[model samples]
Target chain A: MTSQHPTPGDARPGGRTARNTAAVLQATLDELGERGYGAITVDSVAARSGVHKATVYRRWGGVDGLVRAALEHSTERHWEPELTGSLYTDLLRLVETVTSGFTEAPEREVSAAAVAAAFESEEVAEALHRFMSDRHRRAAVIVTEAIARGEAPRGTDAEEVIRSAIAPVYYRLLISREPVTADDLRRAASITAAAAAAGTFTGTPGPPTP
Target chain B: MTSQHPTPGDARPGGRTARNTAAVLQATLDELGERGYGAITVDSVAARSGVHKATVYRRWGGVDGLVRAALEHSTERHWEPELTGSLYTDLLRLVETVTSGFTEAPEREVSAAAVAAAFESEEVAEALHRFMSDRHRRAAVIVTEAIARGEAPRGTDAEEVIRSAIAPVYYRLLISREPVTADDLRRAASITAAAAAAGTFTGTPGPPTP
Candidate 1:
């Protein structure tokens, strides 16, 4: 969805160019979440970030390019599984990190734009689709590792498992007009853990118990 | 959010009032989804519906009111639970209905408007919230019934249970940009069902040699 490294060929004569790019993209997100797709403009982003208009345009080309960069770059890296010796512990940690984010103020405008983009633009939608599918695959690998360790069943759908773990928090945040409480997080984690555990608890516990 | 009955006392003095209202509203939705909110106009709906502008105004008051009324007086209805004496079956049915809806034509616009309306207008937001909450509660009732039937824990947080049952499809629809296929629906139902069943499936087996 974005360049892992900064875009090539846009370095300024001074060393401040990279810093300027990151800052401008950041303001783009801030404004995006505040104003939505229709309201966002390259000029506003440049003004907000205190970058020159030529810098924004010469480097990013236009609003779509800048928006994609901002949205894709705004995504924080997910935590790696800490392998707390139990699948339940690992996933609970994941759940905790996620629940903490619900209160951090919704990036509603950026979110709104991305969603609108998904409906209105196939290019943006494809990038978003790829990003999400990669995430699903990553979670599946972790859950599959748990299954191998005799923590869950091979039949458990890791995608479904991960989704159930996080669904309530989002529903509350986006639709239900409720807060994502710690209690809710703990409850969801508990249920997911219990189900994952039961998968092995009812079946063979390990590799032949040698 | 929608009304079961058409707006009472708002009908025009026309011979075929019901037919006229449906045609007009359908035309309005078509224009809105295709041409967008700003481009849509009362004149267009009247023209498209083959009715006069006076007729549309007499019923809906104007364009904004007409848009609101269309969403409010929608022909679509929420999912109904099919209690096959199996909580899994009931939940699976619900997920399948919701998942399948995304593939149909109206899902994108419906979802966008519901979400956008929450931010666009307070009145629309209130109606959208009621519509969402009612659908959620319907699922919660099913979870509660499952508990009573010993398919889930006696006092499961029915709302949480409901969210878990439906969350995966939503993520798939909103974020993942994938069609929530039947496989996706089944997997969600299976994971939640397993958890719900585990909470109820204690080893006691009803009564201990009573």
Candidate 2:
């Protein structure tokens, strides 16, 4: 969706700048969803955003800069799944949110375009890596809480557990081109939970002798 | 590397046709490895293969056709990992071969380009899906062997098990932009083995009561 841009001479400088940035970034995502990375240009983003081309160039420098900024902005606004106390529920919630993007056509198109961009552009790759790292760090809290509650062994690698939990969904999405059904999400959660409980994800040796 | 082309008028018609196909496909991969999917054209493939542009156009129709043919040819020649009887070992071998493509620069470039192309082109996506399906089916034989040997549940979904085992490696390579290390492979094998033993991958309920 295209965002509303502020008038050029808005009385509030901070609000105006924020709205401008938001409009440009939203336009970037829309363009990415429609045209993909290979075909998108700064002029298209500027035309779509209703922002002056000079302003767009002055602010973002180029398409690469705009793409990185747009991704970062999206990740910043992304909602983290609430931790529901149970690790399995928490993981399932997270997985559902991740896979839900694929179930919706617009969101899936944007995600697919972003993924293709990551492979082609180092700027997008680094930005995406940062975005995913932040997401994993947030999701890892479930594992940490589980460890504290003795649901998982101490020294369990939280990020690794989260990664293992979601890997299958992404594999199906990007590699196999399979529709990631809810059943797949449930299975991924179950598999990761079973493995974590079995201490398969602990980075070190078994717990010290009791 | 570009493959040697067949002479214009070889006595054996079948042999000459096969060699021409091989050369064109190799040239496609070489071009993909160097220029990526977004930039590649049929003229480049023809030039690289030492084949006339008209022949390339007539035979392959367009870039999409050439890409599909090249990927299918590559998949046909691809070596399936030898089944090692033990499910864990078989999965590990398969994962290693898949991740090994990322270890070398040329192969990694080609793979990264192919992944990008899959996102951009339906033809490439279908080709990649078919290629991966063949691999998963071959790897599923390990799971079947495991079932017959009483290592896994009788109703274990072999393809799902195989997908679960290798998903983490693909996740790290594509989404996380992280290296799929030997330790990662070992851990994937261990985690999948534990989950399978726990019946997490069995699509149906546990074995029938004795």
Candidate 3:
């Protein structure tokens, strides 16, 4: 077993090292989707990726590292929310995409596995946090555009708006294990858009309840 | 293996069967908390509960049935959202309770495990669905009371409001893997309450965008 880990210098663009990293991460994701986190091992990932075991361990350290790295690798892929010209439509599209990701095949297994893996590994959990935070930041643009269009106030927390619009969808899909109905999606988008317009998400404390 | 399965006729309140059922399900939850879903087995639960392995299998069928039964058992325990005379405070308390269930010990492990297990078993998924649906129905009393008090419109979707108030917390706790802050709880409650009063949650269609 090599004690030395791969350095940043090994990450040169489009090199053999990059190719190997891509293959290993993709294989790691596939293995996770197929067998889940508990059954995946270094040898399995290495065999699936066609990368040598020693190299896999030398680079990723172990299964936790491999899963975490795979999540981080996914963040590098180009993704942006569809801008549907209005805040409500933009949020509706965003939530629709979120629902599809879990309901659709192939990606469904990988998505659920990633969330499940987080419970078992702090490393994977933190990577998921970073990945989700990145998505949140990217999705905040729709709220920002809405603000410019006079749909919401200047002080609105854009990320919180995104959270409001999509969180219910996540709740139904994963935690509640309920089917995300069309009305569910519409209610989430509409409530969030209206709340934004009402200045509820501006972060100001509400007046004390009488 | 026993060819026959447990029947409801075997259940007698305050009888040996009742005690055994309680012990087995509690042990199942304990095992799930400590070892997670993947590591739990009928034998382990039986050993922990001090019930015989054959009895456990005969009763629960296997690990999946044990988990599903445990979740169903949890629903039987009396649970109601706090009524704080207003929808906002009630939701704040509700979300606080949710955040605590995931961040605190003992229950936290089991809560996280149950959600993770749903990804692995359709039986557990359906059970979780029933459990959360039961929770939603019970918690809707707060909104029902609010409607009576004229805080929200008569037509507001009570369960949907509860979902909106708590979904972001779940998203942060389980999906995004972020720490739930006081601000997050307050914001969720505030947004949902304001939207409830605004009739955004009444299931009415919004005006067509220009």
Which prediction has the highest lDDT against the true structure? 3
| Model 3 lDDT tens row, B52-127 | 9999999899999999999999999999989989888999999999989988987989999999999889999999
Span of 10 residues, lowest total lDDT, candidate 1 chain B: B201-210
Write candidate 2's Cα lDDT for B85-166 as tens digits: 7777777787887788866766877877777789888999999899888878877888888889877888888999889988
For each candidate, the alpha-carbon lDDT, in order, equals: 0.65, 0.81, 0.89
Best of the candidates, TM-score: 3
TM-score to true structure, per model: 0.73, 0.90, 0.91
**Top DockQ model:** 3
C-alpha-based local distance difference test score of model 2: 0.81
Instruction: List the pairs of residues colliding in candidate 1.
Output: A33-A109
Query: Which of 2 and 3 is ahead in lDDT?
Result: 3
TM-score of model 1 (CA atoms): 0.73
Question: Residue B108 of candidate 1: its Cα lDDT?
Answer: 52
* lDDT of model 1 at position A173: 59
Residues B123-168 of candidate 1 have per-residue lDDT tens digits of 6556566666777777677787877887777756666666777877
As for lDDT, the candidate ahead, 1 or 2, is 2
Candidate 3, superposed: residue stretches over 4 Å from native: A1-12, A207-210, B1-11, B207-210
The stretch of ten residues in a row with the least summed lDDT in candidate 2 chain B is B201-210
lDDT of 3 by residue, A60-81 (tens): 9999999999999999889999
> Which scores better on DockQ, 2 or 3?
3
